[model samples]
Target: MTAILSVSDLTVAYGGVTAIDGVSLSVDDGEIVTVLGANGAGKTTLLLAIMGAVPASRGRIALRGTDVSRSRAHHRLAQGLVLVPEGRQVLVSLTVEENLLLGAHLRRDRQAVRNEIAAIYERFPNLGQRRHTAAATLSGGEQQMVAIGRAMVARPQVLMLDEPSLGLSPLFVSKVFDLIEEMNRSGLTIVLVEQNTGKALSVAHSATVLELGKVAIAGPSEALRNDHRLLEAYLGGAADIADEPSSMRANSQ
Candidate 1:
């Protein structure tokens, strides 16, 4: 499969501290690739670097094989690269529909933009019901929906999500993952930065485990799911891998 987004030797630093250290990875066209790690492992930093929100101290980023290492955040967005940051970051003062409209602000086709808004409402009916409500008044799950919908309005070819499952109820987390799977099935490539290991691996085609700002293990989700030692070392403890599928048990042996 052709890579829709590629990062080679990407590194990000702040003052004397290097947050992302020579990391390299790729997201193939129409695949869901998850970046898994504990907090401060530089998962969020990698996503920000790819979106050009943070300057890379080294390496290259290519979108659909076109080099965009130095591109500005908006430029990357225009190139069909969009990031739904960790905090959901919806404009609290704006109504749900207004916030969604902002995602398509860079587009010149007003009518098409309007249609896209309607389509987003169709995909997320909860947002449609509260279209006129201020984003600040929405619940955490609702705000997350707004964030994802807002990014969708831009019609991105590659969408990068940072800690999308953060602070949501179990039901909402499942809903969010379901939406991601649905979107990927419709041919959208995704780079998912998440700490919710089980759900992340369940939906991901491949997994890359980041440790101390570098890749410690990278492979197909099925293989990684069965690697108990690697999971215990980087992902947490034995309980984390205890829920592995029965098929993974055979592979573990």
Candidate 2:
């Protein structure tokens, strides 16, 4: 499979501290690649670096084989590389629809944008029901859906999500994971940084566990999932129990 997104020996530093050190991973076209780690392990930093939100002190980043190491965040977004940041960074004062519209600001086809937003509403009926409601009034999970929708409007070929399930209720978390599986099934490539290690593993085709700013283990998701000791030793948080069997089946079949 051709890699849609690739990072080689990437490193990022904050002042004197190196956030991501010599990390490398690849997300194949239409495959879900997961990044898992404990706090301060630089999981979020890896996603930001890949999206060009943070400068890489060393190493290279490529999207669909095109080098984008020095590109700006907006430029990366225009290249179909998008990031749904860790905290649902929605414009609180804006209505749900308005916030989603912001994602297509760079798009020239107003009609296409409208169509895309409609598709987003179709996927998240709750958002459709509250399209006119202020984003601040929505629940945490709703805000997360809005954030993901906004990224979707940008027409991302590779979507990188940072700790998507953080601080959500179990009900919402399940919904979010289901949405992820549904999107991946439709041929969207995803690089997911998730705290729910078990869910992440089951959804991903491959996974890389970051440890203290470097890759501790990287392999097929099934291989890692079965190695419970390796996961428990390196995975930063408690793994959730839910496993979407269909997602795993997609890989084995």
TM-score of each: 0.93, 0.93
Off by over 4 Å in 2: 236-253
**Tens-digit lDDT track for model 2 on 4-49?**
8889999999999999999999889999999988767898888888
| Model 1: lDDT of residue 70 | 88
Which regions of candidate 1 fall more than 4 Å away from where they truly are? 238-253
- Model 1 worst lDDT run, 10 consecutive residues: 244-253
Q: How many residue pairs clash in each candidate?
A: 0, 0
Error of 1 at 214 (Å): 0.8
